[model samples]
Structure formats: C-alpha cells, structure tokens
Target: MRQRNLSIPRTSVTALVAAMAAVLYLCLAALPVHAAEGFDFYTDSPGIHVTAGDALSFNLHLAGSNAAGSDVALSVASMPEGFTGFFKSGSYEVTKVHASGDGADTIATFQTTVPSDVADGVYEIVLHAASEGGFEDDLILTLTVSGLESGESNFHVEYPDQEGVSGTAFSYSTTIANNTLNTQNYNFSSNAPAGWTVAFSSESTQVSSLEVESGSSKSVTITVTPPEKVEAGDYTVECAATSAKEQLSTALNVKILGTYGLDLSTTDGRLSFDAFANKESSVTLKLTNSGNIALENISLTSSAPAGWEVSFDSSVIDALEPGASKEVVAHVVPGKDSLTGDYVTIMSASCDNQSAQASFRITVKTQTGWGIFALVIIIAVAAGLYGVMKKYGRR
Candidate 1:
C-alpha cells in the first residue's frame, strides 16, 4: 500500500474517482423520490342556504405546496337529485383547472342550481379535485332550501282581471304552490271595498285557512261580490296568502259594466184602467232606464184579452239615458163581443236582454145602443099584450 501511495499513477486516481461516482449514483438511484404536495381545493364558505329557484355559488381557493401547475380535474362526487353543480373560471364554465401551485389562477367558482319545483330540504354535495400526481381533495358542500323560496311569491292566477256586473260574483282562479319541505297552514285575507265581500274556496268549499302539503299545489276560487249599488267602473281587490313562513299578495281587477234594466209603466203608475167594449182608449206609457247604463232599441209589446188590439206610438225607443224616462202613446181596443167584466193586460218593455212587464186591468161597459134597443122591445111587447086582451073582451 505504501508503494502504491508513493507511486500511484494519474490514470489509477482517475479510475478510482470514476468508480466512486458510479457507487454514489447507484445508491441515489436505489432510494425512492417523494412527490411534492401538488395542490389543495378549499372554499371559504363550505355551507350555504338558498330558496328554491335560486342559485348558490362558492368562492374556491386552490392552495398548494411545490405544485407543478398541473391540470386539476374537477368533478362532483356526490349530489342530491334537486341540485346541479358546476365549476366556473370568470365567465367561462370549466371542469379542469390549471393550478400553478404558486397561487396564480388558483381561484375558482363553484355554483349549484336548484329547480323551482323542488321540495325544500338540506342537501350535500362533494366536489373532487384531482391532479396527475395522484393528488386529490374532496370538498363537502351543504345547502338548505326553504319552501316556495324566500321573498318570492308562491301564488299564481290564471286570470287576475275579471269582468262582471254589480250584485254578481267575480271569480279568480288561483293556484298556490307549496314548494317546501314541510306542511303549511295558509291563511287568506282580502282588502275589498266597503260593502264588498271576498272569499276563498277550494273545490266549492269556502275556506279561510287551508293545509297544504309539501311540493304540492292547490287551486282556489276567489269570489268577489260587489255591493248592491256599486258604480260602474274598475275596482281592485287586494288579497294575500299567508303561511307560517311565507306571505304573498296580489291585486285583482274587477270591471263593472253596469246592469241592464227596463221599467215599463204608466206615468201615474196606475196598473188598472176602465174601458168600454168596442171602444178605443189611448193611455200614456212611460219607459224608464233603471240601470246605470244606457238602454237602446227598446221594443214594446202587450198581452191582452182575446180579440183585443193594442198599438204603441213608438214601438221601439232609439236610446234612453241612465235614470231617464221616455213617454209613448198606447191605444187599446176591446173586442166588440166582450162582456161587461174585468180584463187583464200585460205590457212589456225589452232592451239589451233586459225585460220589464207591467199588468193593467180593463173594465168593459155595455154600449148605450144595446140598452136603448132592449127598452124599445119591452115597450112593444107590453102594447101588443094589451091589444090582444081588449080584442078578446069584445069578442
């Protein structure tokens, strides 16, 4: 060994150095190399709550330690039936996120959507983020849904506006949707005008409050009755549907077009009249518009004793204003053979599907000519009888 140290050649030293380098390389190669912790997915708010028909979003942060900016694939590992989850980067929706592991482009948006018709309840979703280096993370998200959605109306009307006349019912078909996880007792109320009545009914049964099941809908009939003398115009009925957790209000329109009416009578309002047989008598008839709307094309007709004739000077009135009247001349003639007795006559006025009838009585009197003839016959009979008696005595 002393001789080798003293006389060691440069080539030998070089060979030794090369051998050591090889051994070191072998040792290093035999040892396993650990992979770096690529990236991590997390959200500041892992739990949230929203009503049905609303969307929920979470701001995600991708933290890493010595990450290689690998493409992290995002997926929802678990979700409920009523929810849909997705990832977004800015305005573009994406499923793969490129994480530099250096905190650049590490923010993402996770959004979940719920259907409007879904029932209310709590839901859980698991978001999975995976990378090429077998690095992965599962984030749990929680969601709570209230029924019918908060601050949103749960009532729908097939027809919010209705048209009718006074003293009639105006109906509105309404549908109430209980998109909740629990049953509810809904109370109804209305702010109608004075002397007006508002009622809510289901299946023809009136109800002030009703119990509704979850995820179910109920149809109700809203009946609004105007006052007796309600003016013709547009009226509003404010109604509300209130539950334990929700309240919805709506305004309904009711159009009043007035009513159709006709009044037929004498100016003095006398229902009876006396008339002689085979004589024509003229009477003044008055036609009044008893409704708030105008009346037009009013036709006059009469029903009287058999063989009697009746005529109107103005058979049809062109138009009559509300609360106004028009006078017409009606000539009535009795049958020649009619006896001295009481008779009935019906006068009718009709316009615009409205009709009014008035009844009158007539008394027929015997003609003077008939009475005079009867007296003359009696006198002739007496004179003949007396002449017969005198002739018999002389014989």
Candidate 2:
C-alpha cells in the first residue's frame, strides 16, 4: 500500500532535469575564463653551495595563472646564519619582479654567499614570493657549503669597467657584503685620476657611507667623471669600502676612445659683425679643435643672402692638432644693391664626424651709398651755379 505510484509525472521530471542542466551551465559560465589564479615560485637549481669567498646564483621562476601580469615581492624568509644574499634582475639588484601572469614564467636571479668564516654545514632556506592580490608561494632551498675560506674580501661587482670618450662619465655597480657577526658602517672613496670626480649613490640617493647588518649585502652605484681636458687613455679607479679595522677595495677601468670636438667662433667668442651694402668686409674666424683628437680635412663653408660673396682664406684645412686653433679670414661681400638691413650669415666648419657652427649678424649700412648720392647732388648744383654766374655776369 505505501509503494503506490510515488514517482512524479514524465513532464515534471523532464522540467526538473532541464532546470538542473541550466543551473549547471550558469555556474560554469559565471566562472572566470582562466580560473587558475595563483602564483607558483620555484627554481631549477634550488640546492647549490660554494666556497665562502665565492657565490652561487639560483634561477628562480615565478608563474601566475592570470592572463594579466602581476608584481611579486620577493624576500628571504629564512636565511642561514652567517650567510649573505641578494636578488638581482639582470645587472641591477632588485626587491621585486614582474610576473608574467599569462601562465608564463618570469625569471629572477637569487645570489647568495656565505661568510668567509662560517663553518661547514648543510642549511635550509625559505624564500617567499607574494603579490598584492593576496596570492603567494613559498620555496624551500638547501645549501651545502664547505669550510670558510680565509683571507677573502667581501666585495663584489656587476661591471667594474666602462668605455667611452674622454670627458665622459663612467659608472659601475658594486655590492658590499657584511658577513661578520656585527653591523658595519662602511665609508666609500675612490682614488681616480687627477681632475676627475667620483660619486657614490644607493637607492638613487648620494651617500658617502653605507650601513649593512650582519649577513646582509647592499648595492651602490659609483660614477667617475673625467675633466674637460682629460687625455685619451686607459685609467684605473681604485674604489675603497672601509670600516673600522677593515677595508674592501676594488679597481674599475675606464677606457677613453678620445673626444673629437670642433668649435668655430671668433677670438672673443663674438659671432656678430657689420658689413655695408655692396661693400666688402672681413672677420677673423677661429676654428679650434677643442677635443683630444686631431681633426683632418676640415672644410669651412658659409651660408649668406643671395648674390652675396663669402670667401675663406683657408677653405679646407689639412689637419689641426688638439687644443690648437687656426685663423681664417672670411672676406664677405654684400650682394649688389642689397637691402639696407641686418642679415645673418652661418659659418660652418666640419671634419670627419665633427662639426661646429657660428652665426654672424651683419648690418648692411646704406650710408655709404647715400654719401655718393650726396656728392653727386653737390656736383650738379655747383656746376649749375657756375654756369648761371657766367651767363648773368655777361648780361
């Protein structure tokens, strides 16, 4: 009696099934297209160690499932005692990396070095990669270091050399490691060439000294600028990081390709001169090779108004040594019956890959022509007056 037709009608059952199917479809559609929204931090070589003086780097990979990129902050959650480490993106030290959130992997280099005095041991390290979107990932690293190396310096550098023309600035990125058990205040200095200047900066701020805690490292940028008249050569800049009872020194090399500069001006640096209409004028122009390199086949040219004549005594120079000057007399003739006003003349001197220009302002004076007209009028009036005097005297 209790089992009498307990099932629903066929239509009702079909409707219920359709409703359930619709609900399932809606749930799937509401989900994100890329639901794998998380970060994975890993490395190909997580366990590596070197001698205390040397260092090792880990190629870390941080992947995000979101199609849009993300910014991930990286940190060393647990570092072994007496160990120094830093993170780098290319040659620059970095605290974060941009994760390629398109399900692709972003790479970072994690560099670590133990103190030169640490004991031989195997240690465990923890690194964390977290993003602002509350997604995070952790990585475990293992290191097996041998006994510490004695009498080793705690200084490292990315690039300690540069090449450029003379009078250019040479920059280097250096890292100072404090591996001792105490914090250190390290003063900075450089013994560069004469008439050269050295500067140090950390985090974009200039600093003469830097402080580092135990088992930590800091990065600094050193810039050396040569003087205006510096010679072309290879020079070594000895940079020093000194603390109480300790000093770390590194030498940086700068190679100058030799500057080649040309300057065209007057003796007094005055570029303006005056010339009368239809009259000839002259200006002594100086062509100086102010660079360290000699200039060859220097060609001098001028741009003036139409029909104007400009001739240089030395239109072309065979060669001019550095720090030497050559005088050229530029004979400028105004155009025939040129307008009485100020005009511009562009004087140019160009050598192989080097050039200079001087702008001269020439004032065309019509007073010279006016003087001749006045003389002609006076002659005519005097002739007329003489003829009239003769004729009237006879009458």
Candidate 3:
C-alpha cells in the first residue's frame, strides 16, 4: 500500500471553510423557527349542559404572541347535525378578531343552539382559530343535551290570558324560574303596543330587576295599561327577563272589553233652558247611549232651586240600546214667590253604569195683577176729582 500526502493552500482552505459556513447558515435559515411564546386560546367553559331547544353560550379568550400579533378568524369546524353556531362580540356578531403584540388579550363569545327535535346525547363541537400569519389553534367543547323534565328550564315565564275594558289597567301574574346552579340577577322589561304603559312589580313594589336563587322561582305582577282612547280590539304584550347567562321571553294576549258611556242633552242640543215664575215650563231631554252595550232601567233625577216642582214624564226607562236615543219630557214649575233673576236647575240621567247631567236657567218676572189694580185705582180717583171740581165751579 502506498500513501500520498496531498496538502491544500491556505487561501483554498480558508475559502472552503467560509463556503461551508455559508451553506450551513442557509440550511438553518430554511428550517422553521420556534418562538418562546405564541398565540394561545382558552375558554372559561369547556363543557356545557343544556336541554333540547335551548341555547348555550361561552366566552373565548385569545392571548397574543410575544414576537408579533395576528388577525385570527374563528369558526366552528364541526358540530352535531341541526346545531347552529354564532360568534359575537358585545351586541354585534364577528368572525375575525385582531390581537396586538402588546401582551393584551382579546375576548370573543360563542353561542350554540340545539334543535327542539334533537335526541338526548353528548355532542362534541370543534372550534378552530386560524391566523393570517399561519398560526392555527383548535379547541374542543363537549355539549350534553337532555330532555326537559317537568317544570325544568334554564329560565321560564308564566302568565295567564286576560280580558279587560278599554282604558283600564290589566295585571298578569308571571312566574320566573332559575334552574341553574348559580344565583342569577335578571332584568325585567316589556315591549307593548304604542300608547301603552307597562310595569313590573314584585311584592307590591315596582322593580326593574330581581335576584333569584339557584333552583328557585319568583312571581312578578305585570301591569299593562292601554291608552285612554284605545279602540276595542285584541292586543299583545311581550315581557322579557334577561341576564348574563340567559334571556327568556313570554307573550300575553289581551282582549279589550268595550266601555259604557252616555250623553244627555235637550232635544235642540241645548243644555240650558229659560222659565217664568209661578208658571209651568215644558222641556224635552234626549238620552243618547254612546256605549257598546245596551242600558236598562234608565232613571232621571234633578237638583233644583228651593220651592220648585220638577216632574219627568217617564222616570224609569225599560231599555236603551247602544247607538240609540230616547226623549223624555220635564215639567218645571217655579215657586209663586220666586225672585227675579237667573236660577239654575241641574237635571241628571243615569242608566246602569252610565250617567250624564244638564242645567236650566229660570228667570222670575213680577205678576201683572198688581199693575192692573194700581192703574184702575188711579183712573177712578182722577175721574172723581174732575167731577167735584166741576160742581164747585158751577156753584
């Protein structure tokens, strides 16, 4: 065996070493780099229990990476069939979220709904968050759906159907339940028709919010007042109870019962009349039923000056139908010694639940008998004096 000793130049060796170093640097640069910290995702609730036809919500938090921030888009990658998912921020829905490199965390919310006809079982929901910079993370949430037992719900509202007259206040007894394990503070509100006033009261005191313990319920009274001039019809009111965890609503139907009213006036549409002292005056009054129902046993009454006699032709009426009018005659006799001036006599007509009033003025005049007697006496004295003067002149 022969051995050959081949030696390289210093420049060549130095050049080769530099080239190898460059190649190593390039290979290392081509490899993926791992950072000390990166985008992280977490949620407060990883497992939730709900009933069919119910909704579940949770919050998701995202911590930014130390090196750079990213705009992450969130979505539900997979879920059970007939399940609907929503991502929201305060009151608006959002799909993409932005985080800064300043070490601050961003929060997003997730909501899922289970269909009413779904079977009771455990379902897995996969949530994915992908960044524009190629950073991706996935989280798994477990959902357990069960059939709703009797009188069991996350929240509920109970009310009775009601009927009331227009312009009247209607109250409903409503029961609210809290079926969760934690005590909840719920805010009470209502959506009513225009020109209506609605309020909620607990234990006779008006309240805007109330606290209910876990697995307990409270009864609240909801009062709905229609406008003064509302027409007779059917109306609806929607009442809601809201909290951070849940929102519930119920509708109440109300049928308005028409009101009863009456209008009383003279036949000439006049509310006042004139009369003479010591004489009989006749007046005609008409009663108009302005209500929706018929009125029975209509009666007439009056409050007149002292020593005045007032009589009605028909003191009691048999029946008065709605949108109909009936006339009655009144005979008013002023006192013999009634003074001359204006005097008022109030007449009222009432039937069932309705009543109306009218007034009349009486002007008493001096009797003509005294004036005629004085004139006759003056004429007799004048004639007698003239005869006496003539006889004395002739003597």
Candidate 4:
C-alpha cells in the first residue's frame, strides 16, 4: 500500500476550520438559553404571635450563589386573612441578581399589616415571581398567626400574681385579633374566683361573632370586682376566650388584704321602772356586735339599788364571734320604808378593760290610809259609852 501522503491543501484546512467556527457562532447566537430562576419563600421570623391590635410582617428572599444579572420579579398571589399587602415601591431595587443553583444569595421583602380583628390561626401565603423572559415560578409560604398571649392582654393574669383581698376589685381586658384569611367572631368568658363578683361586657348569650377584616385587630375589656368579705391571700380565676376560629385561656390572679371590720348596736342602753315599797320589778339589757371579725373579751358590770341585784350571763365575756351579742338581767326589790322619787344607778361593760356606761332608774310610792280611820272609830265608841253610864248613875 502506497502510503500516499496526500497532504490536504492549506486552503481546504482553513475552510474546514472556518466552517467549525461558523457553526460554533450559530449555536451561540441562535437563542438566549435561560437558567431556571427560582426563590424559596420564607418569613423573616418563621412564626409570629400578635395581639388583636397588632401588625403581622413577613420578609421574603431569593437565595442563590455564583449567578448574577438574572432578575426575578415578585407578586403575592395569596395572603392570610387579616393581612393587607403593599409593595415597598423603591424598596426592592435590583441591587443584585442571583441564580437558583448558585451559592450566593439575594433577598426580596414584602410588607403586610394584620388587621386588628384578624382571627387567630395558622395561615399560608403563596408568592409568585416572573423573569423578563416570561419564565415564572412560585413559592409556598407558611405563617403561624396566633392571638395575643394571656400575659399580653389585661384579661389574663399570670403566675405568682394570683390572690386578691376580699374587698378589692379587679378589672381586666381581653382582645381579639384577626389572623386568618377570613372574618371571624370571638367569645370570651371567665370562671370567676371565689368570693368575687365577676362581670363581663361580652355577651351572656352567644356573643355575636365579630367581623374582623384581614390584617386587623379588635379589643374588648372585662371588669371584675371582688367581694368585700373575701379572706386575705392568693386567689385564682380561670378566664377563657373563643372566636369563631379558636379558644385560649389564662389564670387570673388576685390578692386579698385583710379581714372586714365590725359594727355595734344596742337597744336603749338605759333602763327604768316604778315600784311601791316592798314591791319588786325587773329590767333587761341587750348588746350586739355585727361584723365579719370576732370581738374578744367583753364584760358587763352594774351598780343597782341598795337592796337590788343585777347579773350577766358572762360578767367577762370570753369572745363574741362575728354577728354575736349578749343580754343581761337586773332584779329590783324595793326596801321597806324606802323613799324614792327616782333612784338612779350606773351600769358598765368592759371590752378588754375598755368600758361603756349606761344608767338605771327606779321610783317608789307608799301604801293605803285605812289603819288610822279604824283606830279613831274605836276611841269614839268608848268615850260615848263612858258618858252614858255616868249620867245614869247620877240621876
């Protein structure tokens, strides 16, 4: 075989090289190939808790590395119930662009306000982004929307704050927030503490569900008043709130200070009577203490007529517990030949050596005049008989 070194012409070699170059250029110029541009949607703070009157916010980002100059436009396709969407106009300037598979990152943010009446619940938002070349992608976002915590609202009493004085009054308020994609109504209630007078402005009947706009908040105030006689110390109340959507509760606290005071009453402290000599009469005295607390160590003492006597069930009362009283008796026996227009004396009661005074009075009168008449008649008869007898003898 003749190894005919058929060397191709230099022109043929150059033309072949030119054709390869032309083919490479055609492939480069034929169409602008687009790398897939995508972003993961996320909340700036993954979970959010807000009061009924609070606002909800979420920030989004397009995270990637290495790739640049690829722009992704954003739009919100779905929003939570109470959220109001607004674009931060000059805010999302394309400072930089990032590719989906790259390691470097870029961020895009959207701001939304939660209405005061937003219902409490978990919500999901969908975000959409499009490239200038008509390529579009979407990200599913999750947000947890919750009502204000018990400690955040006035109606809620937290740990260690429990217990209220018997007479102290408590006032608390509860708020409802719309945190869902729809309108919601809320119901609120309380398991009042013992010895407390509890009242709520919320309906006793099923509360009409309130219409809360998305991204808004609404509030309600509850008032509690403790009973005047509750003992001093810690007390607990269970309060709950429910909406057409959800229910939550808090343990209310109250502190009672001291015991209630006492009031005293007496039916006329003074006593009086009228009697004849050698006659007798009696009188009664009453004392009362009306209070929540006990009265200790009560006593009664008396100074009566010279021959009269007085006594008490307890001359020294041991203790008069709340709402208790005592009655004492006095006996009067007029002395023979006792002359009395009004005989007066003093009576006293000592509570722990503290004394109170009262007075007693007695009046006396004498008996009939028949004895002197009989004696006079007898003397007249004797004188008449003596005169008759003397005259008869002298004749």
- Which candidate's lDDT is highest? 1
Q: Can you rank all candidates by lDDT, best first?
A: 1, 2, 3, 4
Overall local distance difference test of candidate 2: 0.82
Global lDDT of each candidate: 0.83, 0.82, 0.79, 0.58
Clashes of 3: 0
lDDT of 2 by residue, 168-205 (tens): 77788989988764467899988887899999999999
lDDT of 3 by residue, 1-395 (tens): 89999998999999999999999999888864433225566676788777667666877876656325567789889988899998898888999877664434446788888788889899988988777877776778888877645445333345457887677788888888888655678898878889999998899999999899878989888889998657788888888888756687778788887767788888897765566777888899899988776888889999988999999999988888889999999999898888878888998988657788987776666677889999999999999999999989798
For model 1, residues 223-262, the per-residue Cα lDDT tens digits are 8999867889998898998985678777899999897667
| Model 2 pairs whose backbones collide | none
Tell me the lDDT of model 1 at 349: 90
Looking at candidate 1, the ten consecutive residues that score lowest on lDDT are 31-40
In Å, residue 20's CA in model 1 sits off its true spot by: 52
The positional error of residue 54 in candidate 3, measured at the CA in angstroms, is 18
Question: Which ranges of candidate 3 are over 4 A from the true structure?
Answer: 1-159, 368-395
Q: Candidate 1, which segments miss by more than 4 Å at Cα?
A: 1-148, 372-395
Ranking by TM-score: 1, 3, 2, 4
